[model samples]
Target: MALYFFRISQGRYSGASDQPFEFDSREAAWTEMTAVCSNLLSGISRGLRPNSEWRMEMLDERRKPVFCIRLTADTLD
Candidate 1:
């Protein structure tokens, strides 16, 4: 199983750290949050520019940090 990350900022959600909530895959995460995430992305697209090449570090199966998939505009809070 692969790991994926989801996050929201302080003002974005009633949560801590703004850190990621991990999943086994992007599809899995999206499936669990389809309605909410889709709506948020649609709203953000109305204002913010799309980030086609966003990047971030994440841990792999070996527990070593490595550059993973480029984040989509979907990561926006």
Candidate 2:
């Protein structure tokens, strides 16, 4: 197993997981990342403003970025 961390950000607000989680495979980490994205989007009403972007960064045990999922929203003016 490997240790990983999830770092999330919404426009100007950003935060990272306080603790590490163990995963047996990279695919498993990706699965969790999607779940986090779903949770964030479920609560998003009109989407993030002033930036309209959100992201989930997956980091390895060494605190290095292994992968990322970024969401961008746009509106027709």
Candidate 3:
């Protein structure tokens, strides 16, 4: 297993988890990112959040960005 980090980036705001999650492959981490994006979109549709530029950056144990999933109001349209 390898460690992975999920970092949130929205406009100028940024946050990250100090603890890492162990996953067998990058695909597993990607699956988690997709779920997170889905939840964020749901929150926007439910009027729980303002639709804006949002994304989750997936980083490897070495702190290198592996991929990013981005979302915006246009995504809902």
Candidate 4:
């Protein structure tokens, strides 16, 4: 298993995960990240702080960013 970190950023507000999660592979970690992003988006839709620049960054054990998922509120007709 390997350790991974998730850092959340919403505009000027940012926070880091206090504990790391263990995953067997990067693919697994990516899957988890998607779930997390979905939850956060739900919160926003439910009257949580709406942020146009909300994003989650995935980092490896060495603290290097592997990928980032950005969420934006765009109006569609």
Candidate 5:
């Protein structure tokens, strides 16, 4: 399995969530990202809150995309 660094973008907190969490692996990162997004969408669909947006970025010190899995709110919807 490939290793990656995943980061949640800045200023994404909605007063209910945390800011800027990171994952050490792509699979773990995707799992966390999906869970957060699912919760957010569920909240929005139930009229409990407005849609929250977040950006996902993956960086490679070697400038390669072979081991990256970057996803954002826009990518989900």
Candidate 6:
């Protein structure tokens, strides 16, 4: 097993898991990250403001980035 970290940023909100998750492999970590992203996307089902961006970053035990997923929202009048 390996230790993994997850952090997120959206507009003025940003946070990370205080405790790391132990997963069997990187694929498993990716799965968990997607689940988290799904939950966050649900919150924006209503709508998003112009120039809004959401990011989910996965880090290793050494705090090095492993992978990142981004979602951007824009509105034009």
Tens digits of per-residue lDDT, candidate 1, 7-55, equal 3432233222234456677566556555545556555546544643332
lDDT (tens digit, per residue) of candidate 4 on 1-77: 99999998876888878799999999999999999888778776564354366779998888789889987765555
Give the C-alpha lDDT of model 5. Answer: 0.43
CA-lDDT, candidates in order:
0.44, 0.84, 0.80, 0.83, 0.43, 0.86
Clashes of each: 0, 0, 0, 0, 0, 0
lDDT of 2 by residue, 34-76 (tens): 8877877767635566548878899999988898988777776
| lDDT leaderboard ranking | 6, 2, 4, 3, 1, 5
lDDT of 6: 0.86
Tens-digit lDDT track for model 6 on 1-77? 99998988788998877899999999999999888888878777456677888888999999788989988887777
Candidate 5: clashing pairs of residues: none
TM-scores, all candidates, are 0.30, 0.80, 0.76, 0.80, 0.34, 0.81
Query: Worst lDDT window (10 residues) for model 2?
Result: 42-51
User: Which one wins on lDDT?
Assistant: 6
The residue-level lDDT of candidate 1 at 8 comes to 40
Q: How well does candidate 4 match the true structure in TM-score terms? A: 0.80
